[model samples]
Target: MKKITVKITSILIALAMVFTFVPASVVATEDVTEQTEQQEQVEEVVTEEEVVTEEEVVTEEEVVTEEEVVTEEEVVTEEEATTEEESTETVVFDDINHWAKDQILKMHAKGVVLGDDQGKFNPNNNITRAEFTAMVNRVFGFVAQAELSFTDVQGDEWYAEDLAKAVAAGYIDGYPDGTMLPNNYITRQEAAKIVVEVFGFADMSAVEGNEFADFAYVGEWAQNYVAIAKEKSYVKGYEDGTFKPQSNIRRGETVQMLVNSTGEIITEAGTYTEDFATNVVVRSADVVLEDLTIEGDLYLAPGVGEGEVVLENVVVEGTTFVAANANLAGEFATVVVNAPVAVNIVEQASITNFVVNNKAAGANITAIAAMVFEPKAAVKVNGQDVVAGSKVTVSGGGETVVEPPSSQDPIVEEEHSVYEFSFELPTEIVAEEDVEVAVTFAATEVKDLGYENVRFAFAVATDVEDAEVTFTAVDSEGTEYTFTNEGAWGPAAGFAIPADYTAATDWTLNFSKAGTYTITFQLVTVDGEVLVEGTQEVVVLEEATIVEEHSVYEFSFELPTEIVAEEDVEVAVTFAATEVKDLGYENVRFVFAVATDVEDAEVTFTAVDSEGTEYTFTNEGAWGPAAGFAIPADYTAATDWTLNFSKAGTYTITFQLVTVDGEVLVEGTQEVVVLEEATEEVIEEETTEETTEEV
Candidate 1:
């Protein structure tokens, strides 16, 4: 079943020229970067060499089985049949040789634009602001962020949502008076800003010389944007040296500009050797290539010419586009597709992928020899899959899929599950705010805990005044567990688990007021023994602001960003306030959260008074929240907390000012640099210096 269709022999032996036509003036060239973004690379990593052997044609006995012919109507749904018929219809326009013909037609086929009803694409007509916004919306796949409120734009207007979307995306704006001149033609400078914003190129700061004679006429706000557009070749000056920033852009020129800014064209009849270059567009010409290698993208414009475009020994490194055009009616078949646009990939050619829009146009891709669709690639014709090494013939009528010789293995994906115990809590919260905490108990695989009546408890270690904790709900074994609060608000509360449950459970908690709270959860058996425990920290801020500077409780110090190890460092935390009475609360509790970014670094904090007196700081609270003494109310206080590091690296010590009830009013972090431990020789020298000084 995987063997190549016997047609390969006949196809390789015969090479045909499908048509003959003259060249058109439609020339398009897009840069590699723009096209590459749309392309999905198919990574081909072949570790084992594949062997190919010649196949001998053998005479087979006919089985005499009747062949069945299935009509499209019989197999496809009515809606699908209607859609197919509409997509294959022909699209013809009066303007054929215009420079923007290919771009306009391509966009039309893709339903990005539509010309007038007279089948005439008045390319020279000025494009209105509303029309341009609609086109941008289609081209960039923008959705309505909100309804337009502009006075000139009605709610039911077709372009209203598009205008709103453009504005919401911050790529365009309305006039100062909350009006958007939807009917007025957008000026060149205005369009430049929108284009630059859409492309995210607004930060190009280096200014270039005035590229146009009327540069002085350019507004100050748009000067930088205009310069960048010109510098990137998105816009060009006229022959008179004036940019005409106020000039209205014509429809044809606008299409050309949009296409040129994003893609490239190949008009000359020669091989394109630009490897890895993207956005290569071939339109309205009979082109021949010799050993072409493209790593970006290749676009074939629809109905541009009648001649065959031949690629010899071609290698497509990106997604190749066979049909890239659209019409104004938003119809798939917007252009009148003429003679078959035959793309002959010579024997031994390979394509990473190919895409064809059957609704607008089609291509005849003749694979003289073996053609490969690299692994992970997406190759489709008329919404159908084209197997690799298969000769695909797609016309305006239908598509044909030729089977390949060897079968490809279907890609299989592996799903890996990981176990992690985590909780979601706000890092910072205002004081007196009600907070809900969620904790997740998770495991990678199915597990059963053969236990009954397990007790779950959530505990707070920090002493917080007026703070209340309550268990909200617990979910386990596809059921919810409810617990009642018994006025046991401060320290800990427990919930009873039913029998025969799974390993994971979700717990919800509610807390009142603001404070530095050390939270711990424990899973215990009914026998009062703790099975597992976990801990986390939370800090709360005061809601009210201090009116006077003297009432502000503040802390400040110049903390080093980094340090080397083995070096003696001076560490001090300054505490300041206006007056003794300014300390609004009875006590200003200092809490230290010990943390470090350095691996295996030894850290010790020793509190010292200004008179060289040492005081001990207790870690009475739970881990991550070490409670210190209240600041002396006399006013400005400086407590030197000497920090000692064993290993050289960077570390951070966070200081929190919490209420006696456990609410954190203010907090600050100091980063210290700990260098690599001092070398033995340096340590000996320092020791010798101390001894010599003493003598």
Candidate 2:
């Protein structure tokens, strides 16, 4: 925990909620057997807030450089060095502006390490993990390393990979033998050092946070790493600010560290909280990082693939882009990117660290909260560059037409009203650094925070695909937080969601603030227009407080189908109050037939359910439309449960329903079901199924 490399706040975790085709606010946890047929639920009162945010930096295209995509064949092959190659590789080189030649030139051109003809940048030579570890620490601005792992590193043993990644993720420990042989090739042990630094995040947001036992022994070589990490607040220490430096970090520990680093910090190992996260349907190109928590609800869209769903909190770590497609663990949520985070890249993994160049696969704004950082436009902390995939929940958008919020502006105070506004921020900025942002939400007449909804938005450009957009929440103390997410959105569009996992990025973020404060966002564009364009306003009259279970509306409507009955006609009774996002439609029951005969005519149907058993449709429309009340294909031929008109008298069918949250949308009979005639065979079968004949 010395320099901040293994802390949880610096990582991005995976999505917290189990993804489904249901609405974002609620998730369905049941034995869901059906996987086909997507049904749309009508939202009655959803306010389409056009939240367009302006940015502080130049256009995204200018702020970042797009990495040119290359295939394996395009890369310099391992074919034996030609005579011309050796001659080229032997050219004299200089340090400052090395006149690179031969293998060095090939490596440099292919995005590898650099050296010169005179002082040869041995591009074709084998490198060590230890070296990679060291380089990673340097590139990512890991707190200067103060400790070594085993004695071998300190011995005349070289660790190229370890050196690169260690420097990138920011920490390194020597071997049992006491000497760091800078020139010797490294082994797997050396490479793991860097990998562990980027993956061992522990969520530290809770009052009683996680504690590392090695808090006592500060390794002789790892001391510098421990100090800087602790100072930056990325790495935490015991109450005494001491960390266990000599312990060998584990692989799982690596996963844990990297995840915690991106955003959240946990104090306890087995402590888990169950929170409801809502997956919002995005109409805009840019996704606000904060909105998509590591713990989220269900996403109601129908899609597949990585690009279809945008990962909100994924981070990129490492000194170089290794293979361009590697994984990083985040706090509560994690995501995969198509580039190597130069600081977190593993050196020991490859002999020639420059063999493969890494870069992102571009990003798509028309995605599910897609986050993309323009190429090369990364924010730096203490001079160390935050990897390209780090999440920054910037809130500013494009310049707002509304005047900035100032006391001078007309103070439109109301008895109880809701206000709204929109603004923008840049994708690249320093953490814990309060940026001067501007927004103008309407001064609401509603004063209660319970009723008024506050929304924040950011934008991304369509052309910027394969780039990473990050969102992190930093607390006032400069500590980042954690989210528990699966990090996978259903596949539909061009992008494919990575397998669910936990990862993190290097940034200070936290969403657990005590009181009301202003927020900001970064705006992006698609087809040249602002990508996520729109606006809304909110007033934080009070802190965000938890509310009791309740329903906003209690109502019903006529089904979209006809209610008349000659034969067993299908008549649906809608018990939803259009504005219902939850509770308004759940656990309802209804019978189909003439008023009195309703109970006599047995009928059943099948449909998709979203909220699961949390609620049930007793009669019909109980647990939403997908529950049971659907028309059975075998009964009513409009093909389902047919209602037979035996005597053609006044008859009606009724329905009853309720929500798992305890709200009832419908529990009355529609009196709409009228049966005309049952087929002769059906009548005979019914008679035979329930008859006792006399001789």
For all candidates, what are the clash counts?
45, 297
What TM-score would you give candidate 2 relative to the actual structure?
0.17
lDDT of 1 by residue, 1-695 (tens): 11221222211111000000001000011110111111111211111222112353212121010001112322222212223234323355674333344456655654556665566666545566776666555554444364343445656666666666666445654654435677666667766666665544565673677566887877777777777777655566553456767666556556655553444445444444443233445553456544545544454544234444555555555445444221111111112221224444333433333333222233333434333222122244345555433445433233344444344644333322333346787655566455566676444343333333345555665567767655555343445444432211111223433223334444455556666777776655322355556788877666744443324567776544444455545676786764445444445466775576666666666675556666544322221224435554455667766566777666677787777678887677766666665557767987999999999
Q: What's model 2's lDDT at 437?
A: 33
Indicate which candidate wins on TM-score.
1
- Per-residue lDDT of model 2, residues 104-223, tens digit only: 333333222333224443322223333233322322223322222222333233333334334222333232122344434432223322333343321112222333345235443333
Q: What C-alpha lDDT, on a 0 to 100 scale, does residue 138 get in candidate 1?
A: 52
Ten-residue segment with the worst summed lDDT in candidate 2?
A: 18-27
Question: Which TM-score value belongs to model 1?
Answer: 0.29
